[model samples]
Target: MPPEVIERDYGCGDPSKYLRAGETVLDLGSGTGKICFIAAQVVGPTGRVIGVDMTDEMLKVARTNAPVVAERIGYANVEFRKGRIQDLALDLVKLDEELQVRPITNAALFVQADGVAQKLRLKHPLVGDESVDVVVSNCVLNLVEPKSKRQLFGEIFRVLRKGGRAVISDIVSDEEVPEDLQNDPELWSGCISGALTEEGFLRSFNDAGFYGIQILKRDEKPWQTVEGIEFRSVTVEAFKGKQGPCFERNQAVIYRGPFKAIAATYAGEGNITQGGINMGSVSKVSHRALTEAFDEPLTRAQVMAIVSPFIRRATSTPA
Candidate 1:
């Protein structure tokens, strides 16, 4: 879906590329069904796509476009549930008669509209634990309050089947988010106030039982700058398994044998020292190289070359 159709398209990249056919995928914080609609194409008819959004207005727009989009592609596998990402309780029934919706109680999939900051109280008449194959989120997780972010991850863990993966793209800060900046309403709505430091963000996933987390891609451009707070757009991949992340972690596995160097070598006052070197302000090195070099990026060859040697160890056991 285009940004013009729905203005809140702040995603870093399309995550549906990683989804497999015939797998059930869930989109948390799904806004206007942009990614959900796109995911429907990839998953096919046999697969399912459930889009959960808290905003009624957004859900209205999403539902309006869902039929058209699905008809255009000839599949009705995509669905939008009106509920919060953190607390999915659209199927719950209260003892009193006032708190009931006939359609929600009867539907196969029901989602509630509640803020992720609160604890989720879900009744499993609809979706259940360990039921989904993949969970995808785009540009919305950062807006969630810090206290309930863990529960949000736990909810993802609870819904995912074994070997399920989460592909998400969000805004991440390079440094700690100051309390004052975090509390700013403008920043909060703009997707910066609730931003997590890159390390802290990954740790949250690990703490919630996700393993083998790795960055698929990272953008050099800063998306939003509020009160001098800068952030990056990163697409991350994590698995709900006991094994280590597919990408390298802290472990420094040496390249057992010398192979090849594709790029021309640069020699100056300061330059990257070839294998697995992180050169940046953090490294305190000023090399006469491309701006991309200072970014510590992986060239096509370099990214492929490191696959054999890198070994990642889980920093903590799953909770």
Candidate 2:
């Protein structure tokens, strides 16, 4: 792989520290296998790292790098599968259509020119329910269509073992955005405009049945801004366990010492503040930058600040 591939690529944050050796790890939107390769090293020979990507170009790059990386690291424990974050399944429907084959009566009967069926092991979304030890993502969740974002988190929670963890880094907005901004596909794909407000982000995890969702690290750098809009990157860590929601449960709290937070200025005349419950600074981040400032859940003041505008717009809906 070219050095630029590793250097030029943008992401929310590094999510590898939370991983452990001999543990199965899944990387959502695993672009170019950057996180996957790092994760493969952490898991060692006994463990596995699965990279899931919606873009074929990215998967191609990741798949191409797999063998070389494995050779260099001396471990063939990493694999990449192509699929959307919301639909992590192998997408048999697409595969069948691409190969111009009818649906197979049984999984065993399915076959492709490249043996995609066998390659993907037909496990799809592949982690299997309650089968994975950890799930890591970098700046990919914001790209998912809003309608499927909830299901994405639900799937992550479903795939995790009882005490598994979901560590994510993505761009997030300080407040709800105007409709024109949200509709802009450029902003959407670039990781801006459609970002979940901090409250909504944490709420989505809670709604998906995750416990102990905390922000382990964050940066206050706002990557881009237009007009009055601003964005930042965040690294969020949430666990699947007996504990309750981080924000709702009084005891749940964030551990801020693992990663250092550096303050960066926001654009277009705005100020961001961290909430009482969170351990990092709250700053407006672009969609691409959302994954960088992954800290504790937003504070009550922060939550209200992030949600109130959207609520007003929602209630103002015309009947």
Candidate 3:
């Protein structure tokens, strides 16, 4: 809402556009609080918005300008906290204040600081467990240290209620970034070094126990190119509540194998003889010979179509 926030804002996507009224929303890496402010309005007077940022300057601007937005909106329902996105329970705000009064200079003091931090986490977590309705992030998750990335994703998964979802917009690489490139501090800060590959991005959500994941948007052209590698924006929507007791839904899997085929159909159909499929292999050469008539992507899609049918069926019987 403030011009200053707008000026300082840097984001790859707007995750808050999907917010609903009366929901508790958490904005991770909410630099400048632009998304948080917009989300506050979207969530309305009854809702609450919390923005977390590790940067003092960004937090300063965000906290200073939050009241302005609240006054304009006729309700104050947004707050900013100082916490690392990867470890939300650390409560950097409280740590800063505690250290000001008594800095840790010895092993005992350091242990005391750790104890205090543990207490803060248990008693007053920056974002409580299963307390948020939605977790939104705009171009920030990649900024976290690689060692802490899995934990960061886990935090996002943890803070959300059972049915909560995460709407994230961040940069993803077409291929795996090299370790050398990842080690570069400049690239790391620029959102290039720590980016995940497209597959890795989706896998992160699945590994974090999210399901029903879908790509909402993908930039066709590279946002930046380096070493012939393309880096682009991808917005993904993933849900947190799909992990429930597995009761059979009467979904029977049908298997059709060695589909009957003429010479045309014999193409890419794994070793086909005049009598049907022989015990031969469907080499890439044969596959390409049959499908090269179409474009490459379609050829791959066709191959995928053929492969998708023979999926490993669930071990269940009819009720």
Per-prediction TM-score: 0.66, 0.67, 0.75
Off by over 4 Å in 2: 1-4, 90-94, 97-99, 103-125, 242-319
> Per-residue lDDT for 1-319 in model 2, tens only?
4453496456768998778889999998888888888888888999999888767777778887788888988879988766667756556445656466644565555543447654553555345677788889988888887888888998888888876788999887778777888899888878986688777888888788665567777667686766576677778877665322222234323324324433322211222333222212222222223334445566799999999999999999998
Q: lDDT values of the candidates?
A: 0.69, 0.71, 0.79
133-205, model 1: which lDDT tens digit per residue? 9999988889889998987888888788866778888889988899998889988987888999888888888
Better of 1 and 3 by lDDT: 3
lDDT of 1 at 14: 76
Q: Relative to the unseen true structure, what is the Cα RMSD of model 1?
A: 15.2
Task: Give the lowest summed-lDDT range of ten residues in model 2.
Answer: 278-287
Model 1 segments beyond 4 Å from truth? 1-4, 89-122, 242-319
* Distance from true location, Cα of 157 in model 3, Å: 0.8
**Superposed Cα deviation of residue 72, candidate 2 (Å):** 0.8
Name the candidate that leads on lDDT.
3
Candidate 3 lDDT by residue in tens digits, 1-319: 7899999888988888878999999999998999999999999989999999999999999989988998999999999999999998889988888888879999999999888889889988888889998899999988887788899989999998876889999999999899888999999888999999999999998788775578988889899997878999989987766333334333222112334443422122333333422322222112222333322223567877876756534234334
